[model samples]
Target: MTLSPVPDRALAELGRTEGGPDTLALLVRDQDTRRLLMLRAVLDAAEGADARVCSADARARVREDWALLAEADRVAPAGGGAAADRGSAFPGDLAADPASASARDTARDTAAGPTANPAATAPPGGPTPDPAAIAAAAGRAPDQATTSAGYIPPHPPLSPARARLLHPLVGPWARRCLRELGAAAGPPTAEGTRELAHDLAHFSALAAVAAARAGISYAVRLPARDGALVLPSLGVLRTAVPGGVPVDVVHRRGRLTLRQSGVADITVRLESGTGAWSAAPAWTPAYALPGLLSGAGPMPLDDLDPYRTARGGPRHHALSGPTTLDDAGRKRWLHSWSAAAAALGLGGEQRVGEAVALLRCLVPLADPPGSAGGGRGGGSCSGTRREAFGAVLSSTPPTPATFAATLVHELQHTKLAALSDMLTLHHAGPQERYFAPWRPDPRPYDGLLQGAYSHLALADFFQRCALTATRPAHRESAWTLHARYQEQVGAVLPTLVGSGDLTARGRRFVDQMVAVHERLEEHPPPRGQAARARAYVAAARALWAGRRIRPTG
Candidate 1:
């Protein structure tokens, strides 16, 4: 599918390791659009699947639901505001010809349009779906036709926000699922094909439920996984019955009722005018981050999505599983986040606001031992995924300052991941590893570049902290960290420039990074602190060399 190009100005600002909310918002909107196209592709592939690849029943169900979703989009109201707030326009013809000239040109045009405000004019992509439909549809019951097996819910449209949320639930899985189904060596074996089709059908059911929740009154035959019906970004509904039971999800007005054959119906109330939910006895709501940053919405503390795994490799380090926190544990996390926001504000209020704006979800990880109470080793360890844009999987840091620094550090990774999606900063080549001062093991070129970019932000964060810290000890600590990261970044910049792995755009990007580093170097740390930083860098290099294995001819 065609993607919007990253304007040179936005690229440069990001290269300097800082793209306030506006630039990051553009990257997010583009990612959202790309995901919409990807989902459309998945549906198209499912529609064309033969009996050998996908069963007729599964294919039929997919086509039905997909058509219903498209109809919902087509009938959505106009003047619904910016796509970022509501969601991108449904790619009605994206699956047919994603790379058409019109699609390519629209990408560029949307970038130039207004996106800074939620109330800004609607983006070009037909009409935007009204998210407020959730409130408007709150008390209405589905007509007989709506509850029938092969009928579409007429009138009420799916909220753009609810529609956008479904992409994260199925987009990444679709990428891999499509690849396996479309393998050049024919599709997988019968058993494998069945599994893929089954998964697609299940995802379709989930999508149906999401669309239904946006005030459309309908009943969906949802399959339960391990006796539970999982709804991404919302909550899970557990039932006593096991196996593939035909559970119907009925939405009337704002109340969602889950009805299973032999089991009692479960119901929950959705807040009016917003996607937020009220507590339900039978459902376990997903954790949400406390809204600590001013003017920023609460981000989901996602621990339930199956596809929340870290992309690339374990070197990025992310925690996995359906991790749920107890009351005390949840309280600790909330407090830490609040303190982290305050600490980050000291460094730069605007930067903190921008980081908060870019963050969509937070995946919690176990904190390291002996790192509590602001210890050195207890700093946050966080990672982001290429497919899961806007989600950060992170461990809680002991101190607010450490947590604040981690936020800045991960923001760089998040920005770079989004930026890389739009532009190719480096060329693909055989694996070449290089020493990254911040990491214990040697890193591949891309990993090294990611490290260098993030560290540049860390250096800037620490420099600001050093200048703004009120206490002398805080000042000293910030200065030490600033000098150390500055040295580490200084060592990596030359390697990146000389690596011969960068594209012209990549070289330009690195040049901007170098410019930022040079300006930071102009204001050197104290003599004693600089010596300590240099010694630390030398020690790290020595350790790496000691562990290096030289290749033999």
Candidate 2:
């Protein structure tokens, strides 16, 4: 009990690192646009040297490169439909909508842009428009469009609702990431800043391509210092942009802003020293759904819409219709767990947040205490995979202590789902489901392990709650819960060890879980409490056994 809390080994692995190999891709949308924001390293050797070049030379080379590309391909004009087909966003830009595209469609076919579609490049009728002819038609001097640094282009106004949704999806990450990129820029700094800006511009163009597919214009407004360099880079990037949406890059006075059609602007500004971050983005159903893709966060009860998107897989249990807890139940559950989260500190509670955000959807299952307090596991359904995660909960947890422990337990299952995505921990084993203390039906090895792993965390949470508890009753409850979970989880561990379902990696992962649990087991409650805990676990196991053993007669 005296040992200070150790960071959950699993969470340390799951935490985000700047530009890690993991997919940081997110689906962003507004009333008129839906685009996938993806992380790509575009600061390759071609642009790397530019960082070392003089500012004037860096600026010139960027402009020249942009001009060539601009000449080769024409930018698509804005305004398209909101709901786009799913496949249009990924792997590459959506093919230009042949229906409404102007004469430029012919030019797109002949253009030399790397991402230009040769299949659709030819314009209708006359040969593809030459750059000079196209330039003349648009009434510009033959040289090309401006790549002027610090130029702020006019943009369509953003809706307040769209702004709220889009900001959370990209703003925070953008500021932090761009700041990091700026800091990494070497001294003389001019060259590096320009290169960094150029990369940002490229990303912005890609964002625009996605927005275009959703039938909207896109623009990324950056801070003054960073935007100065990035603005010039946009000229070059504009040409390279795959033909699709019309996207512009601009640097404004303050935060980083992403402006798309019908959505309010998303602005991200990370201040120095203070560590003050922008207000967390407000949540909306459309905006919130993507969070489920990551499977973590506090999803609003009303936001759970099953029929919204086809991307996600089904949950084993169906989502109940409009599950809104009464105000009393809401206040009680929220207050209890919020306190528990503070007690658990960031490390203990982070897994819960991750689970909420990733699952992004909650179905209120509300089981009474004796029967089952609901279940924890990644999925409950079959068919097309969903970019969502689901968790079922009892209408009211029997006690605050029970509520807190359940939070940790379910999050552990959610965290495991995320880990499963990152690492292949087990091989398929015999489908013969075995008895698990927590579940009514038999479970395969994976289910058994999930239960064991989650309860290990639950046990740890209760154990800590017991130690830090201020009141005698709370202390007693904590110890009792702690013992019960530890006993149940420990019993299941032996089964998991022998299940023979583990791959090499799965074995190692389970070993770590066992190691942590054994360490906690080293500290036991008073003999009376220990006995009660044992009985509690035994009762649950007995319940399951009786149900399973009952004759089919």
Candidate 3:
């Protein structure tokens, strides 16, 4: 049997708790819109918590949602079959158990219920959909776009919200391309316009699915009482959606956009219900529903620690590593970074330090248990809070410098993941060590594109340490080992060249590295060292330059 889905609604609310994921309770009830809003808030909080795993705030939110969910009533489903959307990474493996099943039953019941007379269903309390009810929906799945046939839509019609989710760089273009959608959304007297709006909605749904898979946030930017809205996640908002205005969209320049009408337009709509409406009549201000994105960064090794955290984050397990916490113990462990002579053949005072450093260096950046093929992801941000981080490594020897460096490594990935633009991904992935193309498919990262440049960088760093240090070091085998890594670098050169994500400078660097490789056997630096360090450094420089990017397709 598959493990539970950790329902979207639950994920949404739990993601909001201030303390971290630990507080989230699967049974909590949540209004859909509130959950979406919470999604924004929590993502921000997660980002805010940076490099920290689940925060107390997040856990609190999760607990709250779970409580609400627990209070809700359950119902039976009309169709007993589980809803089929796209095939999941593991089909049904992600569906939640028990409570979610109950919740889905409730949702199906609600959808099948008589459309409550608008007058009868309006609760005196507020406009928010009942949280308990929405939470119940966790068991059911969202409607599918098409059947499980091999049929793919000719054009990926973005979801009604998809166009609005494009990153800032691509937003303007969405407006230009979808500008006509504004006029199309109103009550269409013409059969042609009516059909178009219907079609647009369907397309919007599709776009929404695609955007979701890419992990783009889709919340509309709402106004704040204080003139500034605080968001916990990366997303877009409708700066101008009036209460009654139906959403309109524009998908252009790789972004899907939504806009709102001005107060004047809303007033006119309220006043002129009797009169026929047109674009020219009391037109509303364009809704600038904006969106942004955030990424969790490299997958932590502890993420594989299934039982480590109460929140859906990596947990602290004894297996992760050693835990000596005292200062004396720390001092005793800080010496391994030195050469064989410095370590005095493994028993050196610094050997422990070096091993700790190596673990710090390698494990911090290393691939998560099963994630090796995908290249190293954000291992650095596994802990949602400093306290959480402290707890995970409570037993391990502390190394602040290495810890901080690990943070930097994860941040780069988080920044890339947050861009919300496929094109930028196409650009960034190649330049990063894994050489994964910035495109949607992950296939290119394998083969040789996987580890070349970073290996070059690693070699360069280690080589520099070996050459520059005053301590005695191995002279002969270092070059031999360094030369071998260069061969691995050469194997992936073609993948890098085609990455499409790389800038001209990145391409030039790869080319230069190849050139340097051809002459490496000939250019030994001197009696004490070799040309390996200088050559790899040159190669890495070429890969580093580029303009920030946005999505293209």
Candidate 4:
């Protein structure tokens, strides 16, 4: 799929950290487009894998399921219509009538291109077609070129939950399995092949899960993770036994059931028009952030997925170890969230709305060591990753104001991450070479850029607080913070503009940032606050310089 270039206006607005909701939506859509391309690549590799990697039956099932899903996606109404009525007639049921199924397959294949074999379409219960043929009909070729109009409508838009499943965490796993299957020098051992097969099957099961959640009526076997059947964005069904279980998921007439032999069946009732789920006691519901503002719906808390963090790596926010929130912890977070939402509403509704919209999930982190009951002084830190779009890993903030500031700061990072994906901001270079006023250790250009951009938002946020704050102490604190970040951002923008590493677009982007910093200067901090902020900046730079080690040739 070809990515359309971001318009100049959109880039400028984003550079100002003021893209708001509409521009953010465009960035999100681009990420989804990239995900679709990645999905196609995974499918192509799976189709080309050695036949010995998976059993013939497993291969046939995956292919047939994929074809049926493609057909359903084609016929589903635009904008996802009514939840109960949308894609209600399961494509699997088409197997009963070969003629109808064949016709549907032919239509899908015809739309894909000349590479698709219309005659090789697989009906659910009929003889399975060649895996390659099935792939050709359902998946876009990696080399295929198409305009936006032709590409987007042929496939279904990913739900937020489904998109999370296809994140960067899964990419390496899929690549590893593909490498094992494609090894030509020596065939893998039988045990290794079987393991690879199981791993690859997870992708197919993900497709099945997506279909089930789209209100499609169907019964299919899905592999479980850690003895639990996870329904993305919904809930999990934990079996009594350990290891992965092959669970049968059946969704019919607004009711979904999970069944595994020797385990109690779990049932979930899907709300008629809303697509919300009401599950049995055995099902562990996923945590979802409540809709705190009008027209801003709930977002997943994302604590359940094993892939929530990068595999075998340190947690993103090191100050607080990453862990799932307990019942008490969750209650605390919700209470803080309520206060935070109220604070944000008073701060600026539009800004908070846009920031919240870009956030897909909030992964909770444990409070820092030596902090009692996760007190406010524990020092909260939030982080965003380039590969994990829309996810924010953060420790719970101590105050409503701190929470508001954290959201704005992280939103800046999230926006920049998305922008970097679409456009080249700076060329890669050596690390720990540039000074960042916010950090003790020297940073690379990219880190410096992220810091400068986020600090820009923090300065803007504190400026707003200073103007609106009613309490004298609150106003004074806001002024000091506003002045501090203002000085930091002012110091960094010129360095970025002259870095010699930024692309033309990057230079333009930084110029927009400069404009914002200059505007903030019009209302300078109070005399005492400015003096304190300048002294603080000088001390920080001295400390960083003292810590830096000069290299000897």
Q: What number of clashing residue pairs does each candidate have, in the order they appear?
A: 3, 33, 98, 0
Cα deviation of 452, candidate 2, in Å: 0.9
Model 4: colliding residue pairs: none
Best by TM-score: 1
Poorly placed runs, candidate 2 (over 4 Å)? 1-89, 95-299, 308-340, 346-387, 390-403, 430-432, 547-553
Q: Which whole-number lDDT from 0 to 100 does residue 186 have in model 2?
A: 46
Which parts of model 1 are misplaced by more than 4 Å? 20-22, 71-88, 91-158, 161-170, 184-187, 194-198, 242-244, 272-281, 310-322, 368-380, 428-430, 550-553
lDDT of 3 by residue, 322-351 (tens): 221233332212211111111211111121
* Candidate closer to the true structure by lDDT (higher is better), 2 or 3: 2
Model 3's number of clashes is 98
- CA lDDT, candidate 2, residue 151: 19
Model 2, 470-551: lDDT tens digits are 5566667667777877888887878777756576767777777777778787879768889987887788878877776756
- lDDT per residue for candidate 1 within 367-418, as digits (tens), equals 5434452222534456666776666666655445566677788878878887
**Candidates 1 and 4, the one with greater TM-score:** 1
Per-residue CA lDDT of candidate 4, range 401-456, in tens?
Answer: 56667777887888888788888988858677877888877788898899999999
Model 3, which residues run further than 4 Å from truth?
A: 1-450, 469-473, 498-553
lDDT of each: 0.61, 0.39, 0.27, 0.61
- Angstrom error at residue 235, model 3: 32
User: Candidate 4 at residue 71, lDDT?
Assistant: 43
Using TM-score as the yardstick, the better of models 1 and 2 is 1
Measured against the true structure, the TM-scores of the candidates, in listed sequence, are 0.79, 0.45, 0.26, 0.76
Candidate 3 TM-score versus the reference? 0.26
